[model samples]
Target: MWQKHNPARELRSLLSRIETVSQPQVGLVADVLEHACPRLKSTLGPNALVRRLIEAEAWVDLGFWLIGWELPDWAVHRLSCDDSRWSCAICVRGLALNWVEDVAEFQHEDPALAILGAFVQAQVRKAQGHGPSNVTIFRRVERSGAVSMGPEVER
Candidate 1:
């Protein structure tokens, strides 16, 4: 939609800006994505922008934790139940990853948009890749006193 509707030209007219791919940090990338997600979904459909981002390997570069999922109605049902597969945060994260179609879908491309969509739900909502830097998951929380919820949970 940006390309068709002339995002560059419009930006040039409106803000006199030029696009640059150099030296973009995760915080910078995240700020743009989070704020633009609503408009992106409106303009390109939810999956389209995500698909583009994944194809560009945006997340790998950003090392950002995902948040803010505009979940599908069906997914909301699965995640809402306490007796659900999503009850344990770790378990839910795993479940969401599988649902996202990690492998390539022949017609589409690599990584799959649904996978990114699931990440959109599971990072803070999801976390992927083999890179190590920031981001941490507290795998276990040991309630020190009598307020324990049974045992230490592995996130």
Candidate 2:
């Protein structure tokens, strides 16, 4: 029953709520969503709706990456172990792109982390009804010398 949780549906509903909002408002919503659900942030890169949300931010220049790689603009979702502090499992529709990036090095705190925490908490609460194993956060460190927040996941 835990697997029955439809994140896609939830995401769609959330996106629909902001459909008519202005670009800046959409970005704010995306920021909330990103903090509430980081998986959604990565997934939005490809999603037209999500792209609109990100574009509204005005500060982010995602077009460079979008055009340079010729990557299909589609949504990507992630379901990472709780220990993932910086990077997590990413699910992309067009490509299998999962890698760790130095998120902490950024000068500012990413709003997406807050969204991830909220989303994970909500999902865990829902899964409790079905007696699923507790959601565990796994902190993974990148070999590139970036420090992660929690204990490292043993390879």
Candidate 3:
């Protein structure tokens, strides 16, 4: 039999290859991970791995992210959602540590997230600085492109 080769159907078939498993109590897992280390917080703050751990806890409370992706650092493996094969261990374990070693270092697949994060850092710098009275602060966060007065005078 010759298939019509529908792209949409083919895409759905590929997506189904991902796996999802259910667990009774996952909210406390992040806390356990935190206690496992003394400086987990200062180490991986605002990064992807920490974000996923938070989702694990929220999943128990609001019943989300538990069904689909694990968030931040989840991957498919061997066409199964089995806990033993879950990608968290392989993905998150050393990912954050690498970033800690070098702020510009990122092993994650996506590069756009890194660019967006750099933009946030730029905005933070503008927020707390001394600039000239005539300087204009461009607010890029909004689509309208806001402009506001900067500091009274340059330092």
Among the numbered candidates, top lDDT falls to 2
Per-residue alpha-carbon lDDT of candidate 3 for residues 1-155, written as tens digits (9 for 90 to 100):
99874533432232222112133234333432332222344555534754664555443222122212222232111122243432121122223444332121111122222222222222222233411122234432423475445434323
Q: For each candidate, what is the lDDT?
A: 0.32, 0.36, 0.28
For residue 121, model 3's alpha carbon misses the true position, in angstroms, by 34
The candidate that wins on TM-score is 2
Candidate 1 — worst ten consecutive residues by lDDT sum?
A: 103-112
What does candidate 2's lDDT look like per residue over 1-155, in tens digits? 36666654564444343333333245444443443344444553556744564666532233222311221222224323333332222222433332222010111123243233223333333333421222245666776787777767666
lDDT for 83 (candidate 3): 36
TM-score of each: 0.19, 0.25, 0.19
Clashing pairs in 3: none
Tens-place lDDT per residue, model 1, 17-102, is: 11223233344345445432443446545566555665686763222223223321112212122331122111233233454442
TM-score of 3: 0.19
**Clash number by candidate, in order:** 6, 20, 0
User: What is candidate 2's local distance difference test score?
Assistant: 0.36
